[model samples]
Every structure is written in structure tokens, then in C-alpha cells.
Target: MMRRWARAAVVAVALIAVSCGGSETTETTASITDPPQINRWVTVGGIEVPIGTTDGPRGGEWEPFAGFSHTPQGAALAAITQSVQLSTASDRNWPTILAGVAAPGEGRDLYAAHRGLVEISGTDPEMVPTIVGYTIADYSDTAATVDVVQRFSDDSLASSTTEVVWTDSDWRLHLPSDDTATITALDAVPSELVNLEETRK
Candidate 1:
């Protein structure tokens, strides 16, 4: 299920990138806005899924997968949404990853995971989980490079530099297998979080 969600996120980003014609310059210069209020809830088949919140040095944002499934698409969208929300909350600049991306509900199983991560990890600071960090390590017409820092509950920190290419219309993170392994080791993400009833539009 996680794989499926990840694939869906990849597809969504790819589709957006393609539709956008890949012409926009990759810039992290945009100023960040206030963190979005957690007033909105994702409804799937009419059921409500609870999303978690995160508390960091720069206030807090919703963690992805808080009340949603852990599918590939869900994780991907969660990451994106969390990044946007955190940037806004921190009053920092916005990242280009969300420029033309659509809202979360557009996808069913693909709920945001960052919110959940925030909520869960925030509740327990000992378990420090890293989401997306925006630092301009490299950039080009077709790609942007970033350095991400992932922290654990044991006071240990791991860093990885990844390059995201503009594919289809969205920027996608390119993680090597080793980096993937390192991330997976940090936390045991749930496989899926499905809604029992249909959500109302």
C-alpha cells in the first residue's frame, strides 16, 4: 500500500511537471507564510481520518500519515504538504515543489503524512523524525539538489543530499537505495490507513 501511494505521488508530481511544461525556474527565494491551521480534515468515503501535529523550534505543522494510510502516494503528498505547511508556519520562504501542485483531497488514499508524523512525533519529542528540509544545495533547469537532515529518537542524526529532477511537471526526490534504507530505519511507517466509509465531496 505504501508503495502504491508513493507511486501515486510520483505520478501526480510527474503529471504536474509535464502539464506545466517544465519551464518555471526552480527558486527557493519565495518568502514563507504562516503555518496553515489544522482546521481542514480529509474525508474518505464520508469517514474522518485524524491527522497528527508536529511541534518544532519554528512552531509546528501537521505531520503526514497522522490519520491517513501509509501508501506511496500518501507519503509523497504528505511530504509535500508538510513541507508547505512547515514553511508557512516558520514564516520562511516557500519551496517551489508546491508551485503548481494540487490540493491533498484530489487523491483518495494519498492523504498527507507529514501532519501525522508531526502529531505523533510532537507528542513524543524523544522520537525525533525528520521530514523535508529546504536548503539550496544545487539547482538547474531540470533539477534541484537539496541537503536533508534526518534525526532519530536516540539523539543521533543522519544527513543525505538528494537531487530532485523536474519530471512530468513536478519535482521528485531522487533517493539512492542506501538513503532509502537509512530513512526506513529511522521509523517504521505504517503500511496503510484506509477509510471504512466513502467520503463526501
Candidate 2:
């Protein structure tokens, strides 16, 4: 009879210990907080354009390019156009007219060639003309869209927009949505063309 009683006492003590342990675990779990969602816009080129959060029914818009000047590509294009102006009194400069007119990568080679010519000339390198007044518009986090606008010396304007996706703590270019053929095509094209073509279509 003593042996049976001892066995029962042991079982009772074991149950009490398990119940106490479980309650403590539950309390700890309830007290723990979840981590915040990752933000991606912070990482791309360390470029931080201002973004406005939506409040109630009002949406926010951002313009990143309002005051930026002197991008390498823009400067190079301006140099080329200035060179053309010096060679001939044409009313329109070639480089300025062609800015943002072709595929994104296509203009790089032409701009580089212009830079070479600017170097060959004895003009002050700084005054040799650089890109000015480039702008990024509609920068957003909730809607995920951004537009890039570049202006040239001859008053020509070129603009493009691309879809943005938040992932891994950075905003990545979202693949063109497949729900609409038009949107898919725009996404397939270079970012510069995406905005203009989509608007027209």
C-alpha cells in the first residue's frame, strides 16, 4: 500500500510541474512582439526620394527630379549638342532632340562619343555642357510606380515610368503585370518608354 501511494504522489507532482511550465510558456509567447515589415526603398543606390503616405481618401505624390542637375549622361548629351551648334547654325541640336528618344542603353554610346569630342576641344571641361533638370515623379510606396523625366539644353523633355515592388527591404522593378497585355508590353520595354507608351495606349 505504501508503494502504491508513493507512485500516485510522484504522478501528481509531475502533472503539477508540466501545468506550471505550460502556463509560463504561454505567457512568454503572448508577451513577444512581431518584427516590422521590411522596407526596400532605403537600399537602391542609397537614393532616398521623399514619399508621402496616404491618409483617408487623399493620395500623395512625389517629385524626385525637381532640382537635380549634372548627371553624367545628361552632361555628355549637352556637350554633344553644343558641339553641333558650334559646327553649324542649325536651329535644333541633334543630341538634345534625340534625348530619351531611343532605347535606354542605346544613347550611352552616343553620349560617350560626345564626351570624347568635348575632351578633345579646349573648352573648360566644366562648361562643356552637362545634363540639367532631370526629374522623377509619382514616387510611391503603396501604389508602386515611379516616373523619370530628363530635360536637355534645347528645351526637349523625355520621360519614362516603371512599376516598383517592395521586396527584401528594397524597392525592385516589378515585372510587367500579365493581367493586361498593354501593361506587359510596357514593362518589357525600357523603363523610359514604359510611362509614355502606357499613357498613350
Highest lDDT: which candidate? 1
Residue-by-residue lDDT tens digits, candidate 2, 81-147:
2212222212233233222211123233444344335422222222221112122333333223333
State candidate 2's TM-score. Answer: 0.22
Model 1's number of clashes is 44
Full-model lDDT, candidate 1: 0.29
All models: lDDT? 0.29, 0.23
Rate residue 175 of model 1 by lDDT. 29
TM per model? 0.29, 0.22
Q: Lowest summed-lDDT stretch of 10 residues in model 2?
A: 18-27
